[model samples]
Target: MNEYFIDTNIFMYAAGKPHEFKEPCVSLLSRIQSGELKAAIDTEVFLEILYRYHHINLPDKGADLAWSMMDLGLNVLPVTKKDIEISLYFYQQYQDRGVLPRDIIHAATMVQNGLETIVSVDKHFDIIEEVKRIAPSDLI
Candidate 1:
C-alpha cells in the first residue's frame, strides 16, 4: 500500500514513442490502474501532461488521458498557495543545484503530502534528498 508521486515524464513515456522505457512505463501505469500500486499526481504534473499533448496537436488525446487517470481513482493533489510558497523555498535551496521551478513544485507537492517516493525519468529529482526518484523499470 505504498503511495508514490508520479511525474509527467512517466506518462509521456507511456504514451509517446516506443522507447526502451516505454514498456516499463506502461507496466507501472497498468499496476496503478489495477490498484496494485497506489499513486498520486499533482496539478503541475497534470498541466504539464496536458500542455505536452496540446503542444503536439493532440489536445483531445491529452484531455482523455488526464480524465482516464482521474477515472482510475488516482489521487490528484492540488497545487495550493501553501505548496507554491514552499516551492519558492525549494527553489532557493536548490538554485545552486540548477533545479527547475517545476521540479521544485513537484518536490514541494510530495513533501506537503508526506510522500517520499516518486516515479520519474527526471534525474534532477535525484539531488532532492527528501524524495526517492525511481524509474518505471524499477517498479516493473
Candidate 2:
C-alpha cells in the first residue's frame, strides 16, 4: 500500500520549468530520492522520457534524465510480452473513455506487478478499477 507506480507526468513536471504542478511534483520526487517513499516505473516511461526530450529537441537532456531515473534506485519494471497481452484487454475496455494506449500499458503493468496505486495527475486513470491514481500533491 505504500508503494506507487510513478507516471510520466511526475517526471515531466518535475523536470520542466515552473508550473502549477512543479512544486508538488518536486516534493514528491524528493521523497522518492530520500528513500522515504517507494516507487516504480515501467520501461515505457523510460522511453517516453526519451521521446519527450527528443520531441522538445533536448536529446542530451533526455538521455540524462533517463539515466537519472535508473540512478534514482527506483524499481524500473520491464514490459514483458505478458504485460502487453494484458494491455490489450484494458485498452478495449477503457479506450473510449479517454485512456490512452500507453496508459493502458501502465495499468497492465500495475496489474502484473501487484501495484494497486499510481502517482499521477492524469484523471483518466480513475476509470481503471484495478488501480487507484494518487496525485503527487495528494501524497505530499
The TM-score of predicted model 1 comes to 0.93
Ten residues in a row with the worst lDDT in model 1? Answer: 65-74
Per-model TM-score on C-alpha atoms:
0.93, 0.96
In candidate 2, what are the lDDT values of residues 16-131, reduced to their tens digit? 89999999999998899889899999999988999989998999999988887876768889999999999999999888998999999999999999999999999999999889
Cα misplacement distance, residue 21 of candidate 2 (Å) = 0.6
lDDT accuracy of residue 50 in candidate 1: 87
Over 4 Å off in model 1, which ranges?
none
Q: In model 2, what is the error at residue 121, expressed in angstroms?
A: 0.7
TM-score of structure candidate 2 = 0.96
